[model samples]
Target: MLSDTHPAGPGAAMRSDEDFVRAQTGIAPVPFVPEVRLHMAEDAIALWETTETARGERGLPPPFWAFAWAGGVGVARYVLDHPELVAGRSVLDLAAGSGLVGIAAALRGARSVRAAEIDAYAVAAIGVNAAANGVRVDAAVEDLLDGDGGPAEVVLAGDVFYERAMAARFLPFLLRARARGAVVIVGDPGRAYLPRERFAALAAYEVPVVADLEDAALKTTTVWELAGD
Candidate 1:
């Protein structure tokens, strides 16, 4: 759901990404992962409309960073509970919307954490959220899908299988990362394109979510480790 189109025109220039994010959201603790707090939007539709008005563009992608997705919640919870997985290790949070998973890793003693996102606004939100959590996350706008997953010892992806094109691209990248000996983990709510057979379930959680965004107040999300080379 990354968009190449950034905010433009005078209106967009006047309002910084951080300013827009703060103006549109309120800081609150995620229901399933209360140990972490985020700048979240109360209404998805309202925020989308506001973003459109500010950018003077229509059909822009939804603000995925404005909510703590069920998959991310599950992954963050699992990471916090099992600190050994990331402790003293480098972690790459791929397509990190709000950088929730990366922040959790940092809090759990990850040696280093890098959060990748293609959306500029999302990158800004990640920085803001990381600071709020008293963690340092190297948030950047980069698409790592085309290459082997960097030098990180661990790779984390959450809710990435929702779209067919994305899923197609993501699976290969994750497999390549796993092939390179990086522990690849994914959190998903059984999205349509998830290659379930390729992963082994490690943990599951009933993650509370925004009903309007996910169509369910709570999602049965699962954390899975990529299996096989």
Candidate 2:
């Protein structure tokens, strides 16, 4: 349990996105992917509680940007180690939490990096994190999956298969991107809903994670490419 004092309740007011994230987080290196650093929160649950009160609401989305998730770390490490995979190519980091994967791509010399996250707070966190690493990642708070892949040569998604409904929506979007010649890659720690048949493993990593956020302290994450594309 991480702790913070922001605000809560229906009457509490909202804070500026960038200021709130920056104020609540500190710059630190992700354990597995040390090549890039982010202004991350100390505790995932604490940040979520803070955000709920800060916006005067309950049931707000979790503060995923505060922590470096295992799946993101695995994909980011893969991207950093294999710069050639994205160098000089446009990339889309779907559900770009803290923009870690997108930042890795930008640092690795991608022609362009688009980090799309539906959570406004996550979007702000991505912008701050990118600046902390001295990289340019365009952060958009939109549901890009609702439509087709927009002009990206490669698509990198981290931990998007956590739930059945989310997996259903994500797999279809990824297949469409693959069909259009974009290389679609996903990093997952063997979540129950992942469509294993649709992906081929490219690399695997034992990513360190916070206990409060996962069932295990380490996540055996793997980067997989959409198969039969």
Task: Tell me each candidate's TM-score.
Answer: 0.93, 0.92
TM-score of 1: 0.93
Segments of candidate 1 deviating more than 4 angstroms: 1-15
Tell me the lDDT of candidate 2.
Answer: 0.86
- Per-residue C-alpha lDDT of model 2 across residues 55-150, encoded as one tens digit per residue: 667898788788898888889999999999999999999999899999999999999999998777898889888888999999877898777676
Model 1 lDDT per residue over 104-155, tens place: 9999999999999987779889989999999999988789999878799999
Top lDDT hit: 1
What residue pairs clash in candidate 1, if any at all? Answer: none
- Give the backbone clash total of model 1: 0
Top model number, TM-score: 1
The models' CA-based lDDT, in order, is 0.90, 0.86
